[model samples]
Target: MMEKMNQDGALETEKSLKRNNVVRERRISGAVAPGAGAVFRSVHAMQSTLALGSSFESDHIWKLGCLDGSSPDTGKGKSQFKSSSITNKVCHGFHLVEGQSGHDMEDYHVAEYRKTKAHVLGLFAIFDGHLGDRVPTYLKDNLFNNILEEPSFWEDPKTAIKNAYRSTDKLILEKSMQLGPGGSTAVTAIVIDGKDLWVANVGDSRAVICRGGVADQLTVDHEPHSERRRIEKQGGFVTTLPGDVPRVNGQLAVARAFGDENLKAHLSSEPDVRQIRIDSSTQFVILASDGLWKVMNNQEAVDMVKHIKDPQAAAKRLTTEALARKSKDDISCIVIRFG
Candidate 1:
C-alpha cells in the first residue's frame, strides 16, 4: 500500500510540475508579446518618418510653382508649358541646378503661361541673387505680376517693363529689412501670342535667340567694368583685383541690379529692353543666368542644344554641360521654341 501511495504522489508531482511549466511559459510569452509589438511599432514609425522626410525634400528643394492654377513637377528642377493657340503652337521648358557654393540655391525662375481676355502670354524670367535668396524669391513671385499690372503693358511693353522694374526695386529697397540686404540680377522675357518677344534685363543674366541657325543675343550684360563710367558717376568705383572680376565699390559685381539697399545709390535698376518679332527664321531662345554664361558663350550654348527637340531636355543639357565645365555657380536656364 505504501508503494502504491508513493507512485500516486509521484504522478501528482509530475502533473503539478507540467502545469507550473505551462503557466511560466504563458507568462513569458505574455511579457514578450508587448515588447515585440512595441518594436514593430517603432519600425513602422521610422519608416513613416523616412517617407515624410522624402516628401519634405521634394516639396522644398525644387519649389517651382505656376501662377495660372497649374501645378509644377516637384520631382526635379524642371518645368514646361505649351501655348493654347493652335496657330502658334509655342512651347517652353526650364531647368535649374544648385551649384557647389555650399549655400542654398540663390537662383529663382518663372516659366508660366497666362491667359487674358485677348492673348496668351508666356512669361519667363531668371533672378540670380547674391548674399541671400530672399531678393530672388521675391522677384520670382512678384515681378511678372507687377509687370502685367502696368496699364501700358499692351500699348508699350518696354516702358511698362522699365517702370515695373524701377517700382519693384523701390519696393524691395523700401522693405530691405524684411527682404534682407541682398540684391539680384534679372532677365525677363515675355512672348505675346507666340509672335512678339519682348526681352529685358539688368545685370549679367542674358537672353539669346537663335535665328537662321545663328545665335543673336538680345540683351546686354551690365558688367561693372563696362559701366565703370556710370558707376563712378554715381559715386561708386569699379575695382578689379588681380584674379577677381570687376566689382562695384569692391562689393557687388554687377553695375546694374535690383534691391541692393546699401549700394542702391551706386546701382541702376533700369533694364535694357528689346522687342523682337518671332518669324520663320527664329528657331529658339535661351535665357540663363551668368553661371552658364560664365562658362559658355551665347553661340556655343545655342549650338550645343540646337539639335535637342525637347525644350526641357535642351535646358537640362545646357545646365548639365555647365556643370561638366566646372561651373560652381547656381545655373538656371529656360528654352522657348517657336516653330
Candidate 2:
C-alpha cells in the first residue's frame, strides 16, 4: 500500500527534470545527498527477506547536539536529536535515502517543547512523499506546530490531532498552486507529559512500539484494497491491472494522504489516531516509511533493534538493512528509545 505507480499515476511527473531541480535547489549548498556513507552497501542477491542477521557500521552514531531554533532542511540525509530538557530521558536518531528516485520526498521533524503547560511534550514524525517533496516539507515545517498550537491540544489531544490533520490538509490544498501536484503520507508521534504517547497516521507510513520484546503496531496501513468500499461509495473505483498493484482510481496506491489536490474528492486526509500510556514495559518506538515495512514485518523490525543501545545506531542499522534486503524505494526511519 506504499506509494506505487499505475497507468494514470504521477510516476513520470515525479521524475521530471523540473521537479528534480526544485528539490535540489531547496537543499543547502553542502547538504549531504542520499547514499553519503558506507550506509548504502551493495544489495545482496540472497533474497534475504528480513535482514535478520545483517548489520551496518557508520560514523553517523548518536550524540548530543545543539537543538538550535534553526530547522535543518534535511531533505535527503541523516539527523539525530537528544536533550536533557526537551527530550530529557529519550534517545533518538534518523536516516534517509533517496534510492533510485531523482529526488527524495522524505522528511522528518523532532520538536522540543519549551515552556509548555502539558507534561513536557515532544513531537516526532516521518513524512513519506509522492509526486513531489513539497507536501512533506510543508509537513516537516508546519504539522506539529499547528497541532501544538491548537488550544485544545492539552485538554483533548484526540480531537486536536484530528482537527489539525484536517486543517493542515486544507492549508495544503489552499496552497496547491505553490506546493505543486505532490502529496505525502504521514506518521506522527506525540509524547505527552512523558507518560502518554499519542500517534496519528495517514496513508502507509507507520509507527510501531517495542514493549518487553514484543512489537505492537500503533497505526494502521490504509491500503486501497481495504478501503475500496469507501472509495467506491465516493464514486471512485480501485483498479488492478496485470502485473501491477491495485491503486485508488487506478492511480494512487494509498487510500489517504495529504495534498492530492486533483484526487482530494476521493482521498481522505484524516488520520487514525491512537493513545498509549507509557509504562516501564515500553522500550522504544520506530517510525518509518513503507520502504522498510514493505520488506520486513513489525516483529522482525523490533527484534532487529531491541538489543541496540544507541537509538542513532539503531536508525542507521534499520535503513541499511532495508537496502541490503533489496528494497528499491526511498528509505527513511526514526528510532525513539526511552530509558
Question: How many clashes would you count in candidate 1?
Answer: 0
Candidate 2 residue lDDT tens string, 1-339 = 235331233234334435321211111101112212211111110111121343322222122222322223221222222333333255455665545444443444443333354235556788888776678878887898799888898889999999999999999999998887778999999876456889999999999999999999999999899999999999898999998777988889899999988888889998999998887888999999898898999999999989987665687688778877877677778787776
Report the number of clashing residue pairs per model. Answer: 0, 1
lDDT tens string, model 1, 1-339? Answer: 000001111112113322210111000000011111111000000000012112232122222222333233411121123434423556666677656554445677776556675566777888988877778878988999899999999999999999999999999999987887888999999988777999999999999999877999999999889999988888889989998888888888888999878889899999999999888888999999998999999999999999987777788789878877988777888888887
Judging by TM-score against the true structure, name the best candidate: 1
TM-score of the candidate numbered 1?
0.77
lDDT of each: 0.71, 0.68
